[model samples]
Every structure is written in C-alpha cells, then in structure tokens.
Target: MDSNDVRRQWEARSGEYSPEYYAYYGPNDTSDALRCIFEQFLEPNASVLELGCSSGRHLSHLSVHGFENLAGIEVNPDAFDVMAETYPDLAAEGEFYLDAIEDVVTDFDDGEFDAVYSVETLQHLHPDAEWVFDELARITSDLLVTVENEGDVDRDGSTEPDVNYVNDDFPLYYRDWNTIFTDRGLVEVDAREGQRDTIRTFRTAQ
Candidate 1:
C-alpha cells in the first residue's frame, strides 16, 4: 500500500489504540525507553521533531521537561485530535500534521530542528526507511534517535518464542547499536536494550 493507504488504515484503528495500550501492553518498551533516551538528547527549550508520534505521549513528556518548539507527524486523525487537545498551543501552529511519515510536509528549511526522535515507529516503515531517514536527517540539525523492535518471529503464527500476529510486510530489521550511528553515518553516541530489544540513539554534527 502507498502512504495514503497506510494513513487511512491507521486512521481506522486510531480510536481503538491509545498511548496507554501502546506503552503498557504493546510489543515494545516504548514509554520507559523513550523517556530515558530523550532525557539525554533533548535540551531545555530545544526544537524537536517526532515521526509517528502516537497520542503525543512523547511530546507530553518533553513538555513537562520544559522543552518547547515541538512538532510531530502522525497519520491518524483521532490520535492527532487527541494531541491537539493535549497540546493546544503547539497544535494551533499546525506543527502536528496528520499524514503518513512519508507524506509529511516539511516546512522547515534544512537543519531546522535540534533533534529528531522516533520510537517503535520506523520498523513499521520497512520499505520506506530510506525516505523517512532522509527527511529526518534533512530537518534535524543534531541527532536522530530511534527505538525499534528486534527479534526472531517466523512467518507462521508460531515460533521459538511463540510470538505471533506478525506483519511480515513490515518485518523488524535487527541492527547493533553501531549500525544505526557509525555504519549509517549517524554518530554512535549511546544505546541501551530494554526487556525485548535495542534502543539506539545517534547523532550527526551540524
């Protein structure tokens, strides 16, 4: 499916899914890991851009930390509405665009943000990573931190770990901490693994 199709699909499920479910019960350690990683990269009053920001949980966390000038791209209208209510001021700026990551319009000139962050999001864009990464790097002046799921789950509904309900079209790609930063020209700053997999934070110089 194309970006619009993906956005429509997520829009359908947006009401059914919330930050609480994605954080506590989702297959990823999004809440804890995301908060911890951002604490390191995000500075007070820094401009930030987030891709696939669901329910704006990360934005909420940063707001509490005194970080402003925040923006995000999410395709789910329901989730975007919730974010608008949660962050009325920023939302009014049209900073949060409801479109697929690939379809997000970048009004910011090059090197417009202090940091770019994504958590448990990019893996879903299996075939679209190059485009997403290019956009992220284009807008980010400093860093790009991402948290992706990594493990073995075969095609069948059964596996050694017995984890099923896999979306093979968006299969997870496992990479070491170095791969995200060094190998990909993203400076390897720091990385940590959670209950399931790796959370790698990388940066590129201005």
Candidate 2:
C-alpha cells in the first residue's frame, strides 16, 4: 500500500480502535511499560511526543503519571475527537497534529522533543515514507522508543526494509528499528521483546 492508502486505513479504523475500547478500559500493558520507561529516564516536564497516537489513551497515561508536556501526531481526525472526549485533560494540555506523520514530522525543529515514542505505530509506515525515520531521529533530543511487531532485526536485516502486510486490510511493515535509528546517530539503550511487540529504546549519541 502507498502512504495515502495507509493513512486512509487508519482514518477508517479510528473510531473502531480508540473511541470504543480504549475509552472504556484505558491504558494497557504496553502503555504501562511506556510510562515506566519515561519515568526512569525523564522528568515530568520533559517534552514528549507520540506519533500515531490514537485517541490519546497512551498519552493520557503519561498525563496522569505527572508528565504534562505531551503531544501527539494522529492521521485520523475522529481519533482527536475521541481524544477530546475520552481524555479531556490530555486534549486540553497536549499539542496535536491531525495529518499523516510523513507530512508533518518534518516541520518539527531539530531536537524539538526531549523524548519521542511510538507504539505499534511506526510498523505501519509505508515503505515510500520510511524517510520519516530519519526525521524522527532529527526531532528527538534525548530518547526514542519504538514498540513494534518483531521481525528480522539482526546484522544483515538492518541493510534493507523487511515489510509484511500482516493483514489483507492493513500494512504492517516490520523493520530493524535498532539499526535504523542507530545508523541515524542514536545509540540503543535497551531492547526487549514483548508478547505481541518488540520494544527498543534509543538515545542520541550526542
């Protein structure tokens, strides 16, 4: 699928993911792990940004944990609407972008955010838009975390894109995230494989 098709797919699934389920039960296991990592490495005032943050469920978890300087980039506008309803404090306090990440991420100044993270998000980025990985590296000043579907991410796997359309209806491009960011000038700090995703944390070498 092309970038536009990927964006449209999320837009269509917006209400389905966050508005209903996440709204009721709130954050999940990954969300809790994300918060703990942030707490271990950052202060409450750190400028944090989440890419493809659907309905602020994860960001809301950060907000409740005392991390106030929050932001999100979401392609689905309805997700923002649900964010406003489900996580009102987050909706009011956090900055947000309602557009495809490839289009808006470049607008951020170099090292604009103290920490940047994504959960099951970057894996969906279409191959044509993979350049945004470098953009993400450019914008993050301190830490970057990627919680994505695990796949080939070894010595040879880092050399190229390892893509898989996990579902007929959506694109799930597994990538060697460690090599991708490390080559972009970040150093891997920690990596762990979860039940459903691989979580890797990177920090700017500089």
Question: RMSD, each candidate, Å?
Answer: 5.6, 1.9
Tens digit of per-residue lDDT, candidate 1, span 90-144: 4664367777777664566777878777776665564433445666667777777
TM-score of 2: 0.92
Of candidate 2, the 10-residue stretch with the lowest lDDT total is 14-23
Which portions of model 2 miss their true places by more than 4 Å?
A: 14-19, 152-158
What TM-scores do the predictions have?
0.73, 0.92
Which clashing pairs does model 2 show? none
In candidate 1 the C-alpha lDDT for residue 141 amounts to 74
What is the Cα-based lDDT of residue 90 in candidate 1? Answer: 47
Alpha carbon lDDT at 12, candidate 2? 73
lDDT of 1 at 138: 71
| lDDT tens per residue, model 2, 58-146 | 89999999998999998877777878888888999899998889889989999999999999889888888888998999999999999
